[model samples]
Target: MPTARAIDTSDRHPIRAFLDLRWGGPTIMLDGRAIDAAALPGFVALDADGAIAGLITLLDDALQSEIVTLDAVQAQAGLGTHLLELAAERARALGLGRLLTRTTNDNLDALRFYQLRGFRLHRLAAGAIDLEREADPAIPLLGRHGIPLHDEISLIRVLGAD
Candidate 1:
């Protein structure tokens, strides 16, 4: 298996292209806009064949770092966990004491996965779905699980950094 490595911005076109497949319009404009390059950190895990199997992006914050995007193709194969571990490690290394993530209420799998990984349920933004819809009307109001997307569920995991 290939090891996790810091994503090289110079050679990051492939990574952006891959993420575009999943987030082009369905989720966010991860690749729709040109990157500023001076943005936050990013990383990826490669499989044996040098193909990116997982990707993650960290958004720096004064209080805690937000895990903006985490995608893994091989679910239940430890790819997600590996990426999470790396996030935690990077957070600690960067002096960030905690990590935060937000997902739509319709994402039950994400809810379950975060909880199972020691992320505590924090709070829910009641009008998140409406707000998102207002910002981007193209975003569907229904989730994959048939749940009406009305809010965002916030979760937090304290990193042992401080």
Candidate 2:
């Protein structure tokens, strides 16, 4: 498994390149607007050869944070978990108090993944992705498990309690 660490703005250019290429721009469209992901705080997991294997992007406010995106280039080797751990650690260090994120309803894997890591299903926005697709037409009509990608599900994890 690769080691995960915080990356600052000085590292934006390369991280932007990786993230933009993954989704076709330096922005991730959510709820009908573009989020400049490169500007957010992030963590990168690098392999033995120093190649990036995973990434997590986060946006924080005075009291909490939102995990904008999380990705693992390789599967089933614990890269995603490492990145998630780093995000949670950083959030605690910052005293953010909570961490939350949203995923499309069809993403059963993401739903299971976050729940297993202590995130709880917090909100449901029915048919929200349809509006999201209106703003960013690149969204596919279907997603994992052949489910229609129409709703948004928010999941949250509260920190600093123990």
The candidate that wins on TM-score is 2
Count of backbone collisions within predicted model 2: 0
Question: Tens digits of per-residue lDDT for model 1 on 8-117?
Answer: 77546766666667667213422133333224476788888878788777777787877778888788888887888888888888888888987888899999999899
Q: Supply the TM-score for candidate 2.
A: 0.91
What clash count goes with each model?
Answer: 0, 0
TM-score of each: 0.86, 0.91
lDDT of 1: 0.75
Distance from true position, residue 65, model 1, in Å? 1.2
**Candidate 1 clashing pairs, residues 3+ apart or interchain:** none
Question: Where in model 2 is the C-alpha error above 4 Å?
Answer: none
> After aligning candidate 1 to the native by TM-score, how far in Å is the CA of 160 from where it should be?
2.0
